[model samples]
Target: MKLFRPATLVTLFTLAVSPARAWDYEGHRAVNQLALAALPTNFPAFVKTAEARERIAFLAGEPDRWRNITDDQALPHVNGPDHYLDLEQLEEFGLTPETVPALRYDFVAKLALARAQHPEKFTAIDPAKNKDHTRELVGFAPWAITEYCGKLRSEFSYLKAFQHYGGTADEIANAQQNILYTMGVMGHYVGDGSQPLHATKHHHGWVGENPHGYATNSSFHGWIDGGFFKKIGGVKVDAIVGKIRPAKIVGDPLKPEDLFRQMMAYFGDTEKLVAPLYQLEKEHKLTPENEHADEGKAFLETQLARGGQMLGDLWFSAWEQATEDRYLVTELKKRPAASAETK
Candidate 1:
């Protein structure tokens, strides 16, 4: 038999020690995950989108503040974004904007668009959409299952803004829904943008009939969005927010989602931090409780800080950049044929 050399042994050692399990960090998932926390902060702004405020306040657990809206009104999400905001009538949700409501359900519309365009990718949604007639009071949805997947043909594509845009009502309809239908969907995508596993489907890579201990998607979601973030929560927020400086804008002058896109892109780094943790779990079977409760609390704090900071930057950047567009209304008005949202 050939003698095993030291380098070869080390190479095998590297692979062996490498955590066996991890999820692919697909772009869309990161956006969606970050949306959980983001949508709420963005709630105060956005005048035209009345329903957007309602959902934010609802998630923020101050539904009564939006007194006129009810859980039943929220259910129209099933009908689709346009129908929910356009046809339905909402009152208290819009009072603060101190302006005439313009059916601006960008958050709802964007999600509807995301779901319609790519059902497979957008299925990961806030767990709160379901729950058997009782909305569980929480800041965000639970991981694993959500209303995102169950819906049909609801995804939005921003293809129309492209010059070559063509196709039947179906084609144009889908594309327009993305930017037009919902802008805050930025929150959703920004959230997903941060998860390393969402960047890859290996999302919990093969471990031969056993998942690494201390990990579930909920665990992962919890890690980045929930717990891990708690660790350097104070610090991560500062870091990401700190990164928000004036950069030479690079994107389409007509419809520049570049800022938002870049925010999502930055999340690619989150995967780097999570990979090792998952690898450790796979090889050692580190139960979440063993590693999670106390010691992991620090992990949670740090990761969350990382995620929160990233999240904060994405939100602020998008809002700041979009607001910078002196022609937002003019640009929107230019799309005269484009329909307005309601409720």
Candidate 2:
């Protein structure tokens, strides 16, 4: 696989295992399955079909698969940073949940500005930093999902227009394909955010001044993602998805600034779970047979279910918001002019 930076190669080389992807391929597909099932009643009929679900589940791991591309190796790292955001890293820049910027590039610019001003608090970016930290220092997972949601909305609107304007079979098919790919891509990032490990400084393994003495082993990330599930027969998707609270869209979906508020809210919720994950490791409860593993299992299940619910909600909201606008515009454009006789 292609590495984003030299530092990334070193981190992977040292670890000997821990692939860059979050939640192994199996974990990603499992989450996609749950998200597909939990979609709102108003979701596109096509998405609910068995063929579409199978396609989406298979595509859910595309981001990870892109990392090893042979034809265009650079495409992998271009999106690699969209998987996680370490909220702790934003502190040096004074970017709390309330002040975090709406776009990924803006976030990085702010960090650079902060680094210039507070050289004492933050170290300059160097080749020595691990790839995970390099990405999280200004990760764009939240914004990436919001952007994809907007794209899905546009795709939905066009699909509706095809029906109204007598579009060809090819046009309708193309729109459907776009929608499926966008949803699959968006789901990957959203699912990544659900993993508490993906949001914290202690992503791959515990680091720095640990009084409680958590596991410093490198395999922690891989284990929580797939190993745990493989041993326990996967998460109880139905039970967990049923319990997750209904998704409530709070603001205008078309506006990224407005969407950012809700996005941050969801990210904050996931951020709160980071400590509990480490707590499980500290207590030695991350295995299927361990009596205390139930708590860890419960935490992972909740995160996965929440990811599904949020993705479904975004999909529904985008369709509602965009389709309405598209219909109005198309209707106005097609309306006949008033005759001179009537005037």
Candidate 3:
């Protein structure tokens, strides 16, 4: 397989050393590793190899690495919104998770039309700060997750065709590599969804209302993302490993729309916990030495486990549902005669 080149590895390592925006690199790595643990023994043997495991774990930080490119406006414009979904902002557009479109561009179209019709409901964007032009969007975490799952299924289908038909070793290896890359990168978004802050407009802190008097500290997001864990000693990955259930198919794996609906439900569930997260912070339970520190730790650990379980389920479902690429198989069946005629 085409593993990452030496220079590319160096660059990724450098980027990973920087602070993470969602679950830190360590947390992301844990999610991928846990997912690997969740996979059934009958799944692809190549993926369970030691080298592949390390590759997937390292790649869990890949999407966040894309954010380091400040000079590339296009990169952020496309990649930024995939990491979150501000659920609270949806009501402003008269949309709910159930009502939102499954396709990315379709959702964008609907959001644009809504903004045009109700300009007052949205905040005015300053040209100076809105260079990426993504300020108008809420987020697309569910769509991103669903699309990646579909991509993984496609990879599995083609790999199956390559194996059953006449195909070179290099071709099979490359297909396997593609699957690994997609699985690893997709884990980043899954990890993002597990974080309650990523699901709400109060991601940084309570935004508009003050009925509960939650802390509006901008640092709250960063703290929950990584700092709190750092203070409590890194994510107890081993502690939660046993909690992961075996991977299972999510929705109808053959139907992308079904998977999309499942993702929305997942995000909707996460959004419900946003206020409780704020409540924990307000009670000083998140502090390292507080008497209630263990409670906060358990909450965060559960989120991590949830991400890992969901990721594993998606991967397993993709493998189970992958059908042979019939067109590729038909073409491959002709290859031997074509080569003989040339000879």
Model 3 C-alpha lDDT per residue in residues 266-323, reported as the tens digit of each score: 9999999999999998888989889998889889989999999999999999899999
Q: Evaluate model 3: give its lDDT.
A: 0.84
Q: Lowest-scoring 10 consecutive residues by lDDT in candidate 1?
A: 136-145
* Predicted structure 2: lDDT: 0.71
TM-scores of the candidates are: 0.34, 0.83, 0.93
Specify the highest-lDDT model's number.
3
- What lDDT does the true structure give each of the candidates? 0.31, 0.71, 0.84
Model 1 C-alpha lDDT per residue in residues 35-98, reported as the tens digit of each score: 3344434332332255543443223211112322334455422221210111001111222112
Model 1: per-residue Cα lDDT at residue 323: 27
Error of 3 at 221 (Å): 0.7
- Candidate 3: which pairs clash? none
lDDT-better candidate, 1 vs 3: 3
Clashes of each: 72, 0, 0
* Candidate 1 Cα RMSD after full superposition onto the native fold (Å): 18.8
